[model samples]
Target: MTDPVDLFVIGGGVNGAGIARDAAGRGLSVILCEKDDLAQGTSSRSGKLVHGGLRYLEYYEFRLVREALIEREVLLNAAPHIIWPMRFVLPHSPDDRPAWLVRLGLFFYDHLGGRRKLPGTRTLDLRRDPEGAPIKDAYSKGFEYSDCWVDDARLVVLNAVDAAARGAEVLTRTACVSARRDGGLWRIEMRDGATGAMRTVTARALVNAAGPWVTDIIGRVTGTNSARNVRLVKGSHLIVQKFWDGPQAYLVQNTDKRVIFINPYEDDKALIGTTDIPYDGAPEKVVADEDEIAYLLAAVNRYFKVQLRSDDVLESFSGVRPLYDDGQGNPSAVTRDYVFDLDTGGGGEGGDGAPLLNVFGGKITTFRKLAEHALDRLGGRFPAMGNAWTSGAPLPGGDLPGADVPAFLNTLRTEYPWLPRKLAGHYTRLYGTRTREILGNAADLGDLGRQFGPLLFEAEAKFLRRTEWATCAEDVLRRRTKHALHMTKAERAAFADWFDNAAASHRREAAS
Candidate 1:
């Protein structure tokens, strides 16, 4: 029999990948199994902001707000390539929230987290400042605060990469079918989603970071009962052509007191979204319904001078937030905080059985802290493990000197003088220090191989496949990168066909 590993994590979302990285860095042998692609669920489909959750202040979730606010700078320093500061313009509406109340909330948001690098809040004259150009003239007052934007899917993949680099096994597109506790250890059976191959491993501890599927894993996969439950709250977003000028994003208040974010996305497009509604369906099947789209458009039109319609929406996505159910009647009122349920034994007395740590309810901003707290919960189980270190460590491709993105971008332009300015910016923003790996030996654009679309080349695709665990065209187009948004329908289809044929040929050659 093989030796038992220290930790076995189930899920590939931000939280799961974060935990795996933390555990692996702490010198514990770990294996992470995800049923699908990394961050294919709720993690990638978030508001994509690392903010303090200003609305939660009304609900008195001070702790969550404080931690998240602090995390913004922490993540910014760690991965400056993919995460950076963005100012948000919150147009004050007398009917929704009083100006004084909004100011008070911003005050708490500014001071709650010991903020340093991000600028503090300042009042805005909506009629005068350029940020108010898109806002209706009626809104004369506004508040501008700072938050950070993130590529949520890439964040998960980078953590997985770092974990793998630290000697942990990250298995994507693999499902953990069954986990049973045997002789004070967890025997887990996992099947590959692609090949139907099955494998088993034993671990001293198990972590369930399945996001929306947390309860399903506990109830169906592990057959264990938990006193806690996850509340399913559906949130949706829309991608449309960029309607506003400037890099600043808008945060508009709806009549129901909900806030909608209209942020600039992909340079030429806008990302708007997020409605809170109680969901009772499968997480995987969640999609933006017509009502949700109308609701988002209506909310944006209500505040902005530039009206938006359903036709403006180029793409849309929805995800179910598996919040820790606090019995809140309103789905929006549910806590964004996380809760840890530590089952020290498999229905055994005392400490005679293996440990199973079930994580519930966390946001992207606080994933690192969540991972630290998770390991803290297992301190008793792994006393010899290393101390917490992720806060100061950079993820893969994020080690830009001084965490300065613009400086690094300039360096990239100087080094790759033959590269187009837009292409250089894309590579610098996405890959940071690792751009050289994709640009290797290529003196000009032609060396990048076949050009599938604007900015995307065969060399980048090959690099993604070789290094980032990209297995399919969708993995490259949708998750690993946002090339799908730039490519036409025919272009995307052609690329998919080419990728399929090339991958098949490579596999056959390798086998022979």
Candidate 2:
């Protein structure tokens, strides 16, 4: 056991990491523990867009949509490299939704949260616009609107990185086995997944940001209960070779009234998802079943002229959304908005022992605001905590000149003339201002060390292992970077083999 810190956070997803970053910046001692890698769960499995849920207007979710719209710009400015503006082409159908309704939603989406940098909505004639080239002739009208794309897993890691830089302990592969209120602090016991080593700490407060397993954390880990609950809605996505020619993505409405996003992914592929079925199994065991795959493919086949087959699916993943249960029957209708349940240790509203703040539901777009609001709720507990500062602050490598990627790329190529445009572009998109950390003084491709895949190199792998706590090959391939998507199966196997040997050799060296 150690001296009591100000806060102990469970779960290392985006919400947990965001809260830890906020608290550490405020001078509060914090410990953020994760069972797996940083964003191995739902955080990494999102649709990978910082969107304002434009369809939510029909559900009368004005406040949620507005808040998310505002956050879209905030995140764009904060991390312009990974989070850049993308225009989504919605091929309209008379059967799905009225054009006027769609127009009104787009209008509200434009002005709802204060649009500044991104472009507003525009009508596109499918017969004339290049964006509609792939669409079927039946849909002659479409609406193009703006939303920001994100590197979801990286977003979580960056928050954790900033938090650690501000003096917070980040424990990956560490599970909080128990958290109990003792005296005025909450004692936390964690077990390492790799070595089964045990450690303990105490904190004045505990936060349950465990997304899908939040209830489990409350009932099993912390030995408590809340009046609220999370509805497990499984959303699945499919990865296929990019069939479209443009930089734009497609948002097609199914006959069922659900929308599926066909976003351009990994430069040469499309990420199409997501089915909203009620989930009842363990979150860890979730997978994209055949039915869900068929559903997604059918949605794509409805609008696009290119007919996609089951064999076209390169990869598929499913994530269970732990949405706040508001007694809604439809899984899609269940609120994407978040709710905080603060248990003041039975001392009533303001009264308290060691306060336990349980975060219920949240989306990727509004994670920062969620963190701010979470800290605000615990303001009374930590009277000495500093003011909120993440609003204007840039994430670790997000301090670009006017948030211009093309400009940054130009400067980078000028500095390292030998670096290939594609390689330089990869490093810039992923690492942003910190690309130098990977490049070092390397003059050419040979200096970058062994090539694992087209984009992967020995130097970049070493850098991730050294700084980003990347233990397994999947950590580097799937989550930290999407190199796995580009590599052949045999290539991925070879890379994983190399990773294991390298890691084992390092361990032996340390032991020696």
Compute the lDDT of residue 140 as modeled in candidate 2: 99
Give the poorly placed runs of model 1, Cα more than 4 Å off. Answer: 346-350
For candidate 2, the per-residue lDDT at 489 reads 92
lDDT of 2 by residue, 134-197 (tens): 9999989999999989999999999999999999999999999999888878988999998999
Against the hidden reference, what TM-scores do the models get? 0.98, 0.99
User: Using alpha carbons, what is the TM-score of model 2?
Assistant: 0.99
What lDDT, from 0 to 1, does candidate 1 have?
0.92
Mark the 10 consecutive residues where model 1 has the least summed lDDT.
344-353
lDDT per residue, candidate 1, 1-512, as tens digits?
Answer: 46899999999999999999999999999999999988889988998888889999999999899999888889999999999899999999999889999999999999999999999999999889998898999999999999999999999999999999999998989999999999889999999998899999999999999999999999898888899999999999999999988999989999999999999999999999899999999999999999999999999999988888998999999989999999999998999999999887645324657989999998999999999999998988888999999999998889999998889888988888898989988988888899999998899999999999998999999998878888789989998899999999999998998888888887798899
